[model samples]
Target: MAFGSDRRDPYRAVRLKLFVIQVGALLAIWLVLLSIVYVLMSSELYRVLDSELRRSAIQVIQSYDHNHLSTQNANNQSDFGAAYSLWKITGAASSMSATYIDGTPFIDVRTVYHNALMHPSGYSTTLQINGQPYRIFDALVNLRHGTYLIQVDRSVGPTQVTLSSLISTLIIAGMAALILTLVGGLILTARSMKPLLASWRQQQQFIADASHELRTPFAIIRSNLDVLLHHPDHTIESEMTYLGNAYEEVERTSALLENLLTLARADSNEQILNLSPVSLGELARDVVESTRPLAEWQQKTITLNAPENHCMVIGDPARLRQLLLILIDNALRYSDAGACVAITISCDTTSCELRVQDNGAGIPQNLLPRIFDRFVRADPSRHRAEQGSGLGLAIAKWIIEAHKGQVFVQSKEGRGTTFTVIFPS
Candidate 1:
């Protein structure tokens, strides 16, 4: 056996893998959501700013007249606290018609005002003008006298602050949600793996039990063969006892293997029952007769009791037969010689019932619950003595469950044991 250092924990590895996958999916969704919200919010803020600029430009255009270029409406506070520059052009040559500002223009921003007069393109732009954020746009207006150019500059400091606050809030909230998801996902993943971990542990125990059961028969067969090998000079008759022992061990091993295969197929869902309406009373009679020879060999009397009317149930006949054989054979193996083993059957309108009872050393209360578990036998020595593989009851339980029936045992120590089976009609 290896120490802890050599052991790699599969549970931790599997849980971590599942956690990573869940977190990655959530992170991707968060990224997409954040990006979409950011783009939409930024566009909306800019859109409001542009609308205000357009409204201001429209007011400046309407107030202008070729004969008397007016700056009254352009310089008003309702014009969105803006600065404007206007020009008039009759032909190729143009003149600075009017310039308006709600307050005194700073010397640094005088150049921006000058550029508006120098070049006026019909578009909107954002720029850092004179250490302040500004949205600038130029508009073209045609008058009765000539064409006019207007430039508008609006400070965007407040809008910029709102956008920055929105971005910060989104970041903070998203981070908090991501952290919560990480912790929650780890916990949930751990909880989800519990059933799988339990199943894995059971599988490990099952393999260990099968290995232990197989080892004994193999060892016995090898020992008997070794004895035969030692006396090769003797006639075949002289070695009959050793050969017989080996053959018996071989047969026991074959039965063990066959039972293991049946269980494996059952676990994998590869076993399909051929279902039909089976008469339980008729099947019981057939099983009792076939099992009678074994009862005779063991010096026990086997009898069947059933209702006059047929005990009908929907089931697979072959599996039903196997189930009966397993219970009766188990009874014969454990019962004292000449003990009475009885098979009884009864049916009502809704369900059919069967019972196998033996007057023998009964099962202890502690072992009753797990009596049908694989590789579980009350006495290993007695099971081996009777060539029992310890898997018969497990297979019997599987067959009955496949037919959607239930099997249970009732026993009292030193009295007897009875296995009861119920099938829905």
Candidate 2:
């Protein structure tokens, strides 16, 4: 059951959710972007069409300077020479001249505009004649005697072709972006989760180690108690002392087991944090005070440089306090005699930061990155002897991460180490 439950699928429900989110977001953004491009490009296309219509209208009006309306009026009737739509308003009476050019023929219309009233300067519209489309440019050119309606029509083959090409390009680009986003998002999600998978495997190994470690202490305590039971008549003071020591060892082992269990729950993301606004300065002060005796016992000087005013941040106060204690306790354990351990709490509008600096026999440069990893101890033997199960910093890291915060360390081999905790405000 344990192994089966841990076997995660790549296409799990959570991954599906991520895929949907990424694809939907990308598609929506692309749609909006394409829509904007289409609108702007379409507007520009219409402007070019309108400009050509205006230029054509000016040329056509200039072509007919002489009074040949009557002569051209008779030519309007003939299938061999098709008619074009032209309007001439001589006072209130208007005359339409229909002329044909090549195979294209035009209809006579009184209105200067296509759909609405055509502007006096120029207007353009789509016209269909004999199952062929034409872009018509119309204008009301004012001459000395009367107003002449000039129209110049141009076929929109090139513009339509260009628009078609643009649409194809947009579709291809959108598809490529979507495919890249899906593939890249999946790869990134997998990479992000790799550390979590590694941590889980390490935790399984730690549990096995912890079980063995716990059994040895329990066996020793049990055997010592059994020996005391058999020698009822001989109540040696040394035996009583031995029993007391065994009980203490049993208590220590129990505490270690409890810490391990807590770590396990934290790793599984089962421990829900009771988050609230916490006074970072006050928390640091309390932790510093609590660890003062430990520091003094080790002949180390513990200094607290908490803010004068309360530095508030949103977090689980208890967990934050635990993190502070873990860092301080670690410094005290590893630091040289009479070394200075400084704790500072600072805050801004966006975040609050807690820095714990110690002039300890600092961590090695290479091991600095893995210091927060579970069961990774700087000095394994001393860590065990100091009752440090090498899980303190790891637990601290988990708790900080649960609060959407971070824990990072900077260390110089011989100089000192500084652990920084950042929490969003």
Best model per TM-score: 1
The sequence of per-residue lDDT tens digits that candidate 1 reaches over residues 207-301 is 99999988998899999888878888988899899889889889888988999999999988999999988999999998898889888988899
Expressed as tens digits, the lDDT of each residue in 173-207 for candidate 2 is 88897787777766765665567566656767787
Could you give me the TM-score of model 1 versus the true structure? 0.76
| Structure candidate 1, residue pairs in collision | none
* Cα distance off (Å), candidate 1, residue 56: 5.2
Cα lDDT, model 2, residue 242:
68
- Clashes found in each candidate (C-alpha, N, C closer than 3 A): 0, 6
Model 1 deviation from native, Cα RMSD in Å: 5.5
Question: lDDT of model 2 at residue 239?
Answer: 87
TM-score of each: 0.76, 0.53
